[model samples]
Target: GKTHLASALGYKACQEGIETRFWRVSDLVLELEKAWKENQLERFKKKFNRVQLIILDEMGYVPFNKNGSELLFQLISDWYETKSIIITSNLEFSSWNKVFIDPRLTSALVDRLIHHAHILTFTGESYRLKNALSKIE
Candidate 1:
């Protein structure tokens, strides 16, 4: 369910007047990298820390180098139990080590997440083509 479930969750939280900002993982990393270069990383991290749910969409889709992997690990560890994180990935949990360069970090990350997480594996053909072909009829 990568179809904006986190955005919907965030929207609901916002309706209750809770602040939320949804961003893709790559976008977030890019923005934070930019912030780091501009010496405003604190501002971006603060925004993330304030969110009730930080949904990282499309994890394990793109492999991160060691540094990026370490940065991600730090973020997750920092937010461990302090804030909720929703991660969406097409890859199975067993193959998560493929994404993160370091095995230890991957193990730690998965361990922390699975302890308080609910895994929901989605099954079906791609909905994109299904919806598009239906419109042609």
Candidate 2:
């Protein structure tokens, strides 16, 4: 459901000719790790300099390794204040350290994300689950 909402926003931004990228947290960190190994991390990050928005989906679904966590923090920090980001995460902020490993990094990441953000909390049965059960019934 969160992914669906973010996708709709991304679609609208694209319709308005805004440059946008949609990346799953796991996939993005893996790509960053690859870029780091290839010694092209800067080049890879630079590609986002012109993009207006980035939508990071399913952030807490996979925990990040040290390299992945650090790389993801760097990637997000790069766009802090300059570009727009929409992150969809099921984990509460208090539980984010479980995914990030480093408490300090997790704190910093949450701080960056929450500042100037319009917080939206979804509370209910998942739409997908509700629909599936209704169909079966």
Measured over all alpha carbons after superposition, the RMSD of each candidate to the real structure, in angstroms, is 2.4, 1.3
Residue 55 lDDT, candidate 2, scale 0-100: 96
Best by lDDT: 2
The C-alpha stretches of model 1 lying farther than 4 A from their native spots are: 37-39, 132-137
lDDT string for model 2 (1-137, tens) is: 89999999999999999999999989999999999999999999989989999999998999989889999998888898999999999988899999999999999999999997987899999988999999999
Q: For residues 11-125, could you state the per-residue lDDT of candidate 1 as single tens digits?
A: 7888997756666776666676677778886776787756777778888777877767777787788887887777888888889899887888999999999988888788897
Which residue pairs clash in candidate 1?
Answer: none
The 10 consecutive residues of candidate 2 with the worst lDDT sum are 72-81
For candidate 1, what is the lDDT?
0.78
Off by over 4 Å in 2: 134-137
lDDT (C-alpha) at residue 125 in model 1: 75
